[model samples]
Target: MFRLNVTTLCAIKWDCVIVDEAHRLKNEKSQLYKACYQIKTRRRYGLTGTIMQNKYIELFNVFDWAAPGCLGPREHFLEYYGEPLKQGQRISAPERFVRIAEERKQHLVKVLGRHLLRRTKQETIGHLMRGKADNVVFCKMSDLQIQAYRRLLRSPDFQLLISKDLPCTCGSHLTRVECCHRTAPDGVIWSYLHRENPDGCECCPLCIVLPCLIKLQQVSNHLELIKPSSKDDPEKQKKDEQFASAALGEDAVLVGGLQQDESFMGMSDAQHCGKMRALEKLLETWLSKADKVLLFSCSVKMLDILDRFLVRKAYSFCRLDGSTPMGVRQTLVDSFNNSPSKQVFLISTRAGGLGLNLVSANRVVIFDPNWNPAQDLQAQDRSFRYGQRRHVTVYRLLAAGSIEELVYSRQIYKQQLFNIGVNGTSEKRYFEGVQDSKLYKGELFGISNLFRDLLETVFTSEIIENHEERLTGIHRTSSEQCAKQGLLGEHAVSSKLEIEDDIENSELSALSQEQDGIEDEIESPNDTQSCSESQYEHILKDAGVLYAHRNEEVVNLGGAVQKHKRPKTKEQICSMNDPKTLIPSFVVDEHQRLATPSTLKILSENGQEDDTVGQKRKYEEIFKLEEMDETTKWFLSGSSLCPTQSIDCCKAVFK
Candidate 1:
């Protein structure tokens, strides 16, 4: 048996050792290969389908691990084969270069073949099935989302970054924004530009960019994630400490826009994300067939959005993210795998990728693409490994015409690089050439012509000019969104809810007034001291079950009983709601027959001159439609018209 940790493996003597993905030790300079070289083994088998990513020396290193010094010394091998093969790549004569490269390649392959047992998928098991099928889905950005995206691109921070001519950073930002429709908090951006905390942001430009990117990812999932402006206050420290002391729950997480009543549980959440809409439809179809789904995103912030969404949707789910304490993480994983009630496992790629066996879920949805494709691949393998019996299908969601497309393309390039190194694979036509110098350039995330047009649209349209609050979707919380939007005249949902609470309190106060009026109506217990005691019991009963003591003496105020108002039912709501704001008008059907144009009142004769003038044109339009159709059509076209003359003379001639 072989171990991945080099030190442990070296310490244990083994009769036989097998290393998978042996190319990991292709670098002789790596600690893994050096430590592994010291391991005592009677027979070592190095298994890999990919070897020699950059040079032939990689193949030499792998062989050295499997059977030490079989390919001669590292330096000698490089001088004999690696240098010539690397130089031959730049050689001018194609045939000559091919001959020189092939010779070196054959020698390296011969050395590797002695210790390596290699087989292609076709050669190993003819027509054998693969467990995973990759799918890419493109989501359309909503009109409002598009407007917010353009406005963000035009922000001072983005423009300055462009002016500094940093393409790679721009590219990085683009990749980030493609997933979630956000980049930085507005306060952070404002602070960086002004060197002032107008929005209470104290972060630097660099700090702002990362959070902005995180928020953007959150926005792509749900607009409400955009965090509002906030500042730490020392005055509230005592109150906060006291609140913390009264531990009601393990966490004090307040996810906004989520009502405890499950009222907003349906489709309203999907409006902010096209992907969410797509996912809802997908879930409805797949879940009906009893297919369990494993949904994953790299950001826990995104997983939180999904968690809230799944709960609102009433989907039985289990979650495993970084914050899920180690003890509970596996329990959640096992529960999801075995529990029939749980249909979804909402997972963050980072937390769930390494060692969890999630063979229970047959379907996986990768909500966002990763820069390093292996992270996603590992996440997919979580469900496909060991206990899985079903053919696992993977869906990767991305925005159309977005940086995700570029990232997807880059993933292919990375996979090819791995294939070349581990399997000695070659391509006929390399589509995306790796450029070493481009890592620093902003052109990597270069604003395209389409992006520029969107920017121009933002400047020219009223969408950006007038409702600036649309960008609140770029924030992290509904409170921030509501505060900004409320000030900007958009619906302040929380403020309305607060007003409603005040109105309810006022109604309770009115009930207390009714209680006082009843006391005045009766004086039986009114021996001053006795009446005062009765009044105390009367108030106690009115306080409701929550505050009323069970031992308190009760008085039956039968005549003055207040009827408890029942919550409005759907039908009751419909009945109480008056549909009309204006008086309803009855259609006048003269003798139940359609009225002819001639029967209609000629309004030009009305006494109101201005009204008559407007009506005159309508009358002209009506009568002008009749008789001499060709002549009428010609006259209306303004052909051969007497420009100076009133048309009465020509009309008379026609008559």
Candidate 2:
């Protein structure tokens, strides 16, 4: 563990070397494995529960590490035992497969059993009941998420990655949207390290493809991790801004007491994520019984999101991630096990999966799936390992048909592959897909397994900030509405404040403009002369929606449905527009028929969504967005009628 220099390491090893968790030494190419291979020892022991995680090649490497030439060279091992074992896993005919596997089993045990010993609890004891329960709960992706996923596949920019029509610019606009309904602010570099490799040369495809693919992966799990990056055209942006700004104004309601507003408890970002929703349901059930739960995710971003959620839900939780210092991991683990109040332990899969004792918790939710089945098992074993008294139930939440499903499938293959080498059993199910099929190449992309490379570059951190601002109400309260309420007109609201609020909405115009075929053509107010009754009904309905549940039957008295006392501060205004009452962005976009080309393409491809994908939003997409003058939002005329230059009233000194 000291200086990694070979001379320093070779000098000390004279008698014997024991490698704990010896499966790690399965890779002969790794520097650590190579270093351990160098230490001179007459007698050595390598201890591991799983040696050949994926291929028999690793088994050969480990045998070589412990004893030179024990299994011969890697090539020799592959020819004699590895190829036969692998072929046995792929054999389709059951009778023939099992017969060959039986023959190979005898040969493998005889050859390796001399230096290796593996025994299950049942093998050692006559009969032993298992203490671990594994449950896989399939989750469905939101329609918006599924649409974004399809868009990533077909977007001309993405489909033509290196083409002249679509240069691999820093901004992977079309692809990142697949990861979340939101993504980090634009212009922010996702990674400086990805700009170059260890050799300092520009990374091939990695610089472009990896990040966008990761963004999509994030979308598959939870949108809260990455802010949505899709931008609307300027015109669409202005209209949506007007809607969000005027709809809520400064009357947004902020619920200070989390418990006081039980209705809003479910309104948090947790529901937007399928895994989070499932997790909350699981936690509520377990925590109700006072049982502890360990929740693990590979994404620290997701962990942070969960942390915020648990705190909001008022559940006691402890978290450990890559950012968490190694020195404090044990302390946190102890705190969880020792404290009766800590019911949830949020853990990072890579760090928390290695070797941890978490027997105090009996319920586990693997927040996301992992490609490596062994790592997930290690993470789960934290509770079900040894000291666990209660029967541990581990729930692996996977998006039903999404990439998470594929990853879990791959994990099973790796696991079955491992079993073949150790137990010589071809227990693989027929529909599990081929092991080592490698790339999930799409004919549409003109590429082989690009998605695999994308998935391989494990995501580290995703930008996360509370996007509560964008979730503000869509009822845009205009200057006229302000005047009707005897409130300060839109003029009183500072232009800078208005601009900041519309920062995200600004991009809405760009996206909306791009989808010209879809954008609703606004008709002039004069075009609606004949349909007076219908227009009146529309106005009345709009007014009714504007104020919410107030009585619309006004009698020119102190009461009016849309009437409200003006808010004092922006925060209170936003808080007043209870997020609970706010429309889901997807619903609004749908109602307005503001779907982009990508969304339309996905919809057409899918044709009709099944009931399982859930019902389409009932609120019709807006047929038309009233065109407002460009200067109407930012400035006001100097006329007395106008609420400009802080003028309280217009006495009209004319004539």
Output the number of the TM-score-best candidate. Answer: 2
Residue-wise lDDT of candidate 2 within 105-125, one digit each (tens)? 557756676787665532343
Candidates in order: C-alpha RMSD to true structure: 30.7, 30.4
Name the lDDT of candidate 1.
0.47
On residues 460-526, what C-alpha lDDT tens digit does candidate 1 reach at each position?
Answer: 1121112112212222243344456533122223323333344345335434743442211111121
lDDT of each: 0.47, 0.49
Question: Candidate 2 has what TM-score?
Answer: 0.55
What TM-score, computed on C-alpha atoms, does each candidate reach? 0.47, 0.55
lDDT value for candidate 2? 0.49
Worst lDDT window (10 residues) for model 1? 549-558
Off by over 4 Å in 1: 1-131, 166-221, 225-268, 325-330, 426-433, 438-655
Q: Score candidate 1 by TM-score against the native.
A: 0.47
Off by over 4 Å in 2: 2-5, 91-102, 119-130, 156-209, 228-268, 431-655
